[model samples]
Target chain A: MLLIEMFVFLGTIAFAISGSLLAIQKRLDIFGVLLLGLTTALAGGVIRDLMIGNIPPTNLAEPQYFLVSLLASLSTIIFFERIKKFNHSIAFFDAIGLGVFTAVGANAVLSFEYSQPFLIITMGLVTGIGGGVLRDVFVQEIPQVFRKEVYGMASIAGSVALIISYDFVSPIISLYICLTVTFTIRMLALKWKW
Target chain B: MLLIEMFVFLGTIAFAISGSLLAIQKRLDIFGVLLLGLTTALAGGVIRDLMIGNIPPTNLAEPQYFLVSLLASLSTIIFFERIKKFNHSIAFFDAIGLGVFTAVGANAVLSFEYSQPFLIITMGLVTGIGGGVLRDVFVQEIPQVFRKEVYGMASIAGSVALIISYDFVSPIISLYICLTVTFTIRMLALKWKW
Candidate 1:
């Protein structure tokens, strides 16, 4: 549980930074940037929870996640120039975040006892990519998942792996396998421009 | 209940036409146009249902709504040039849809037994404009509610009216009041370019 929490926290910060960077690039006002950053970091989970009948959502009920995202957005704004120079590092963190989120999303749906593989995969992909999709849409661009690289595909693969292995392996081990597969595929896509 | 269902059906078709028009203007592929049209017609209700913990959403469960949206989108495509000529008429219908959706959204939340006025109003505004917001975002534009006319303001006013009158009048009567107020405000905004 501690490890999963850590993964979620790390993913939140990375997603926040990515959202803030995009907002800054779009030259949105401060409020817009913050709103986009927060949306990118938290809206995915909120959407997922809402779809599964979780009212109010844990993101709203708990403040730590919100604060973490806010802090990351602020830091990105403060160090925009320096951060831009570290694009590769940012991408690396983003890949890790994507991997973790895909696993987390799959695990979440499994707990709901949804036996349909297609639904599980859809939820997993939505959890992994929904935030980025919302952020891009806010800035008036086609979602990157639809137009660029293999982002959503990688998440889908990880979700499938997690679903397939969940019954046979320890949950922790299954998560690690899902994370590794997603991270590798995403990183490779980034490198090769797939 | 029948009257309310009629309002919802009309709103769905109007919203779908608005979405399809915008999608055509954007030169999206047929699939994109259909997706945006369906999303604009249904997403607001979906968002509302999700927030109130209505899982899967009635929009998804009810096939009539989906078919109505699809029919609207197809008609918009087939009569693109003719439809474009009737921009003013379209705007009027859109305003009516907004009004009906606002009332329906407020009424939905009222059943949730939420005591907070702000939450009810927020839900009402969301239900009224959420579909338009999602449509604009998908097409990579700033939400009309954020920039154009007094769209959100009209919804907010209607929501406030509905909340205040619910205790004093029958739900059906309150809905009519809300609809009239929202429609008047929105039409005035269009006329005055507010």
Candidate 2:
């Protein structure tokens, strides 16, 4: 459980870093860049929370997300050239982030007893892809989800796998299986240009 | 009713134009600009609809909103400099657009029989301010809602007026009153530098 929480938090932090770096690359002012990172990292979860009738948004309730993203942004700016050169590495971590996000989101919704499988799947996908969609929109680029790449598809696949495996395997085992499947597919897609 | 719908369309078109023009100003590709405008104009309504369990969203069901926004964006691009010169006038129109969006959003939620008045007012504010938020976020700017010109405050005021006036006036009159009140306040705010 602690490991799961750690990976989830790391996934969130990674997404935040990715978003903040995108902002910095665009030459946005510090406030603008931080806002971009904050919103990009939190928008998906915020939207999900709002849809599930959680008001005022979790980002406001827990301010650590914003603080962490700001720190990440500052660090990226300090190491700009090195960070830019590590694009593939970032994408690989992004894949892990996506897997973790989808798992957490699906598990969250299920814990709330949202019964519709379709809704669960949709939530999983939204939670996984929402941040990046927001980041792309902020960067004034067409979202990758709408273009090509199996970005959200990996998350959905992972989510479905988690749900199916939850009944048959231990929760930890199911999580590992889902993450492995998502990471493999996503990495392969990037490697072979699938 | 047709006239009311016409105003609703006008607000959507105006916001869409603003979004598209921003995208173009930022030198985004055409598809990117259009997607930004579409999402900017409709993200609030889409989120609202999805929250209320309306899948696929109203904008998807009826393409008129998207079409109007597309045309508006194209028109703005064609007349960029001319429009830019009329910044104040455009701001006035933008305020009106915000008012109309607030009214329509409140009407939609009230129609759904949501019992919480505060929630309805909050929804109205979200609907009105959501487009601009999306626009700013896409442009990688801090959302005006978080800081600046009392945007969401105006929407909240308008929603309160609308809900209160519903008891004393015809629904149409109530909408007109709300819109007028919101637009007037916004215009004054702009003029007085409030």
- Pairs clashing in candidate 1? A140-B140
In candidate 2, position A113 carries an lDDT of 66
Candidate 1 residue lDDT tens string, B67-164: 99999999999999899999999999899899999998888877877546655765787789889999988787877764554787788799889878
Residues A15-132 of candidate 1: C-alpha lDDT, one tens digit per residue: 9999989988877756556667887898788777776656756675467888899899989989999998999988998888889888877777878877688887887788889898
> What is the DockQ score, from 0 to 1, of model 1?
0.19
Displacement of the residue B183 alpha carbon in candidate 2, Å: 1.2
Rate residue A180 of model 2 by lDDT: 69
lDDT of 1: 0.85
Deviation from native of the Cα of residue A160 in model 1, angstroms: 3.5
Q: Which window of 10 residues has the lowest lDDT sum in candidate 2 chain A?
A: A144-153
Clashes of 1: 1
Per-residue C-alpha lDDT of model 2 across residues A61-172, encoded as one tens digit per residue: 8877667766766776677789889999888878887887777666666666664555566567667778888788767876665444466667768877877888898867
